[model samples]
Target: MDVAELTGTYTYRSFLNRPEPVDDFNKLRFAQLELRLTAEPDGTVSGELVFSEGEPGGDTIGMDMVGRASGASPFAFTLTGKGRPGSPVADFHYEYDGVILRHWDIGIGQLMTLAGTVLRAEDHGSGATLARAGQTASFLAVKRQA
Candidate 1:
């Protein structure tokens, strides 16, 4: 997939980490993450992911993705954010798995729950996956039209 394929807004909900309140998904309510990515021809990838609903501290954290990716090679980026008292950053890695861009952040403890799958719109369909701490909860997302 390419930049044009990724230029859209995607909203996703994840039931990460268990034992709270299990829905039809069977896992507890974790949170919802919304992403908007703009890929530039100049090889600059930029996007933001918003966290809401599950816990505190998510809203205070600001995350922005900026990186580069090539054919078959993984998309490598840095997520700079106000994760702490002073702004800190983490590395994000994603790969196009033929179907979706499976991604994960370096993860700074409980600071950021940043791992998910992004599926670009194709002939078949578009969707996503949300997981946390090696546990993949159920997720579904849609691409909004511009």
Candidate 2:
């Protein structure tokens, strides 16, 4: 797929590890993730990622990101966060290495899916105390329809 195809707003979800199995008592809970992507002619991709609700009483976070398509790989790209210094998220940055997936879902119909791994390259705010830097998580995101 062309890089432009990946440009749009997407709803995203991530799992700390693999998700837990679902059962009668275990209902799935998901954070709200909004990814807005735009691609340039040179294959550079720019976007914003808004993440919320993963932790109890945690504040929603938004970060700006920039990256380019992986060499000769139209389906792949690596994006890094660009948090401003002194901001709430300034100390922490995330890097997402992802690829577009073409799949059909019975419930969601034809889907423009982006799946990959995300890395917390730096720790931010109070989280820095936890030393969570260099941690990685798997994520799945679907482009929203216009």
Q: List model 1 lDDT by residue over 11-112, tens digit each.
A: 645544455554576345544667666767655666765543334654334345455534344443332222222332122222221123454466333221
Tell me the TM-score of model 1. Answer: 0.42
Question: Taking the tens digit of each residue's C-alpha lDDT, what string does model 2 give over 11-78?
Answer: 98876664566664224332457988898767899988875433577644577889987435447888
Candidate 2 Cα errors over 4 Å, as ranges: 19-31, 52-61, 70-74, 104-108, 127-131
TM-score for each model: 0.42, 0.74
Model 2: lDDT to the true structure: 0.73
Candidate models: Cα lDDT each? 0.42, 0.73
lDDT of 2 at 46: 91
